[model samples]
Target: MIYAYIAVMAITTYLVRALPLTIFRGKITNKYIRSFLKYVPCACLSAMIFPSILFATNHIISGAVGLLVAILFALRNKSLVIVAASSCVAVYVTELLMTLI
Candidate 1:
């Protein structure tokens, strides 16, 4: 039963990916549709990242510091590696200080 469900899910996922490229041979021309599609990944990523980020550390201040650092890096148009590393550093430093205080 689990194998059957997995097979069905695999086929559905495959079709979702394959059908779009196969059907949309021409470049998408609608500006609004293109704009919406462009932001989808960002929206999806934020939805996935935000709640986990907030609750990740035992100390709320640590998470907030990390989140603030990440936002600053993003606003400055830093690369992903920079944003991620800086956020981790911010969280670690904040948590370390929190433990001592």
Candidate 2:
């Protein structure tokens, strides 16, 4: 049963990712679509980061600290790897301290 579920999930994931390329192979030439495609990674990255910073257990303090570091990293033109890693480390350290008392 578990193997069947895993197989289904794997197939579904592959199909969803492949469907767009297969359908749009030689047909995607709109300027707006091209511009939007360029921003997809940034939009997805923000979507993944914002909620965790805003709603974590410590709320204001944790959120502020993480947001500050993230902004600094962004302003300095740091790589995504550094920005994500630093923010995660800050959040983890903040959470650990919050739980200690």
TM-score of each: 0.63, 0.69
Candidate 2 lDDT tens digits, 1-101: 99999999999999999998888778568999988999999999889877666776465677777887878997999999999788877877877888885
Question: Cα RMSD (Å) between model 1 and the true structure?
Answer: 3.0
**In terms of TM-score, how similar is model 1 to the real structure?**
0.63
Candidate 1: stretches off by over 4 Å: 1-12
Q: Which ten residues in a row have the lowest lDDT in candidate 1?
A: 52-61
RMSD in Å for candidate 2, one decimal? 2.9
Residues 14-78, model 1: lDDT tens digits: 99999988998887889999999899999999898887877998777788899999999999999
Clash pairs, candidate 2, are: none
Alpha carbon lDDT at 89, candidate 1: 95
Q: Count the backbone clashes (under 3 Å) in each candidate.
A: 0, 0
